[model samples]
Target: MRFTRRKSTLWRTFESRYYVMTLLTPLGLLGLIGILVLIIIYIIRPNFQQKVVSSTYVWKLSLKYRKKRLPTSKLRDLLLIICQILVLASCAFIIAKPACIVKSTETNSETVIIIDSSASMLMSSNGKTRFERAVEAAGTKAGEVLDGGGEVTVITAGPKAEYLCEKETKENKESVLREIKGLWNDNQNDIKCTYGSDDIDGAMTLCADTVADNPKANVFIYTDATYVNGSVPEGVNVIDVKGEEESNAAIINATVTQDQNNYVFSADVIRYGTENTPLSLKASFYGVNDKSGENGKLTFELKDIPVVANETYRITFRKDVEYTDEDKLRGYKLVEESKLVLCKLVADTDVTTDEEYGVYSFEQVMFDIAESDAFDFDNHYFIYGGKKEKLKVLYVTTPIDKNGKGEENPFVPAALSIAKNYFSSRLDIEVDTVMSDKQYLLTGYNMYIFEGLKPDSMPVDGVTFLINPPKGDYKEYGFDLGLEITSKGSEGDTLSSNSSNKLLDGLKAEDITVSKATSLKNFTGSDDSPYNYESLLELNGSTVAIARNCKENQTVVMSFSTHYSNIAYGHIAVLMTNIIDYYFPATVSGTKLEVGGKIEINARGASVIARESGFTQEEFTLTEFPATLVLTRPGQYVISQTTYFGQDLTDTIYVSIPQSESALTEERYSLENPFTERDDSDYFNDLLVYLAAALVALLFVEWWLHSRESM
Candidate 1:
């Protein structure tokens, strides 16, 4: 496209003519008027006036001579006059610097350049990333098109197709180059190169749509050709700018295991090149001292290990650093300080050798260590060195047989014991059985399990479970038990079809035989009542099980006794386990997280600080429980939290990069006319120069013709 638009209205009016000329200056018009005046005066005025009265007699004869001679001689004079007029007109036209607006039959085609800016493009070689090179190549092509009198459109293929510049001409070429330079800088610094994948196909589709109306349009794609395959659009070209391949070693996997007092760290390394290289596996441990101070760094290195090309090698390291009394005290302080048992693996090498074909190479590949629970290791583990605390559960039951033999309901306690064993590996649960008549304080327990007994007053703290309580008007405790007894046949009432509740996960009501059950009709604690209660199990419009939250305490009420129902013992055991685990979930120290993945945590009023390998730290405050956190980088992240109880919690999470991105090999795709040249230079200036020269030649010819006629 031309940079400037013609004065179209005036030019179009003169379309009937081959060429149209317009004066740029008013002086040119004045020159034309002066020439017209001279020509008129020369023709109309007499050169001389003599005594014509004396020749009156001869005047008739003179008229006869003048009439015949003037007709023949006037033709020569007219030729001279015409030549003079021609010279003047040509001079005036040249002074006006007239620009002829010639309509062309052929239209310039459009050119679209698409560049990839995905994460894979960020792989650098020779001090430049693939993205930088792609941008440069695209910019060069755009410049060529703009110079050839064609329009250019630049698109960046990122997570989405982004238009950098659209429908730009040679006049806007500088602006287009400036935008491309910005992308180059951003890619170099890895500032906004956050796109994980490329959308080249989508970008190409967009380009096709952009040029749908123009048959002569062409599309160029500049990328590493990592994601290019299959069919391409007509008139589309792909430029594969992939660089030479370099040898690289990446940590494919990592894990930690405990053996007695020793902690073992294992990692799998893979080499992607054809040459063997010497590799180093470095492990760094950040331990906490008793005073919550830095306990000095512990580094273990496996150096000069022979790593074969195109092979996977496993390396393992174990250490048994004993934890003294001071270490245990420091473990407690570590929790308060939000310090985690941090461990990191970094793969490196000392070899400075270069490959013959590679443009650039990396000497280090930091391994992302997988995170494990603090208790997964032995007691001497960094954060779990101290003696672990057990959850205290108080079980209160009334005597079922009050005839001198003081025996309590054994089914409920047996279920509780079974549930306790299920979670023994995660956390220790201590169950203390107490008779209903025994005086016991509820403050010391983490959970209270009541069997066939109603407390005088509900505990305002901790989790409580009530089973088959007698009828009572416990208005003070926000519950009024009903005295109605409902009996079912040998077959129990069918479980609600809506059994999506977590409490009824494995237990099915159809399998149970409930001979008798109490209906919770008088238990009025819901939205319509003074208390809040959520019905868990409902049969015939009556609630058989309900849950209530009073202040910070959780209470679950069941209307039937486990002894009366012939429900599977395993099902009852699982129900009991689900109830305890639901109320007081196990503390999760850390988890294995992938890059660009999200992790949800349920610790209210806690601070989450994540620290990466390069000392990059990010802090987030969760005002409520179940906050979502996204891991963006691949490395070890120490996630520390401070609970509402002034207790510090620490967890370690590892974010790993995808395997596809780790293979730093460039792929090739077929391209048509990848290196086609462009014609972008405008011809208006050259045309103007030739026009000026032609006008000068015409003026010379007019002068020569007038002189010859005068002679």
Candidate 2:
């Protein structure tokens, strides 16, 4: 079988001997002039001049003595001349670098080389990164293909796969090499491997055209990635440039949860390769808004934690002080709390382990084996989800009766308070509660909650929440309510809620009982409807609870009073929280994302400015809601924007390297051979070395012959 492998063109050409022998540097043939000089010397070589010898008898004796050996002598003389001529020719050929041209099936075959420039390629060994090695190998392969009179294409698999060069031939091999080498900066500090995880599939797709154009084209990929028990595309070759062995420690993930008076900080730490690796974990909290008499910064550490390879160890930290289960569930009640949490694996030299406020727990012991931990990018993690801004809320309820009693449902106010405490880290909530008889203005509040009362005009300035809205014609709110319907039995009617509704995210409305409800009218699902509404709660095929949104305002109407439903028992708080989340979503949807990950930006302002830790500020205009923001690098980004209501809000997003990239010894599949149908033939071998050896042997033989003749 003639497997079309990339053999050196010169070697293959000479080995196959399909074509006649040739000289690489024909100018060296000038050495052949030595043969002409030798021949000329033989012609002018002084013919035996007839001279009167002093002794004819001696000459005659010598002639007779030589006659016996004349035949041998003549043969020797002829042999010597032939050897001299051959030696001169050998010298010429050696200088010319003689090579045989043998036909090889791969001569005209194209080669496509893909270089993986992912973040994991930044692994360094012997001062050279994997990307550097891959680039070098790619260049060498390209040169070989070009020298064989075949075209070469170079592609890079980074965040996106793209071609570095296409159809490069020997004529422009140098330029192609230059382009590949340009992936690294002069200092080698900045490389094209800034992107996480390679897009190998994309890169291979780029080779499709070349393969189509040349059916015999060979595709090769140089990367540090490995696939475990996985096979790559058929007919492609994968060259793994991984180091001998590598060990890495990564803080793969981190998050904070409110635990009563203290916060619980947890992180996933992993050691890629190395058994019983001893490492320290450090947790630092900045801008922590807590109820603890103290504030500012809090740090905790776990020292000499032996982490096993390939295992994820979850470490959790909380207040050193003790608390109850209730406190644990509620999280420490804090006057103020902002947790800009940072978790990192301490390097070998940093030995400080602080267990002051909280101790840490290592949940698992994972083990795998690798040699070096040179890639340090994934060691640190940041959690900035705890920081929040201010949100103003206004609550209006019915006035007091003659007995100094109010007709208000206390459940609404209670749910609001619960939501305020639950989202304390993300929002500083200020609530103003007033009786319906008092003068209440809704223009300044971020949210307005009204219960058991109807205003002359609907509030259009903020998110409107009408609890047990009374029957009325509310043209300003775009929808009106029908007469209140009373249930016939005390058991009340079980309502079914739209589980898909964002406002009912965690509530089970089917279990709730409502004895009375008002039906909503004119909420048809139509483009021409005055309000863009979504039914949240339904009873007997009628929408009892509704949510609507527009550019000018947002409204949520619950037709049933809290007193008439089982919702006040416990579901009210959860429903309120979901409502707040849906309307006032965070500026950035997620707290953490992988490098090259895209995040949704739902800015309340006209524009948003994102500033990453080590990058320039990026500004995006909010032409619409939920804009896409692509994070290309690993860092903490602060997104800031001012809402239309003049409320300045800021959020933090952490971009990290893909966890897969830290697995230094991940199993990878090799590229399959796409040229199965191609002729498999041995390439021509180079004849330069053999010719030099022959030349040396000829020289030695000529010297021996000359020495014998002299004797």
Measured against the true structure, the TM-scores of the candidates, in listed sequence, are 0.59, 0.61
Q: In candidate 1, what are the lDDT values of residues 1-711, reduced to their tens digit?
A: 669767687677666443644434547545677577867889798879455554676887887876777665677667656656765766666566655434332357689898886666666656566777887888788888889989998888876777888889999989988888778664323344443556676776677566654657888887766435654445777776656764456665666554542345556666566667655555544431111223333455545455566666665543323345754443211111321132222222236763111101111122332222111111011122122236788899887776525687767777788977777544568889999888988776768888777887776556788888777765655556664545555555544424466677777766655545676654454556535666677655566777764335467887787766665366678778888777655334345554566777655123455566434555555545556777665556665665433345555556665544445555646433332333222211123365467667766765665665544
The candidate scoring highest on TM-score is 2
> Measured by TM-score, how close is model 1 to the native structure?
0.59
Worst 10 residues of 2 by lDDT: 359-368
- lDDT tens digits, residues 358-449, model 2? 31222111111222466867778777665456688989887545454756567887898899988876677898998877887867889888
Predicted structure 1: clash tally: 8
Clashing pairs in 1: 1-149, 147-680, 147-681, 148-679, 148-680, 148-681, 149-680, 290-330
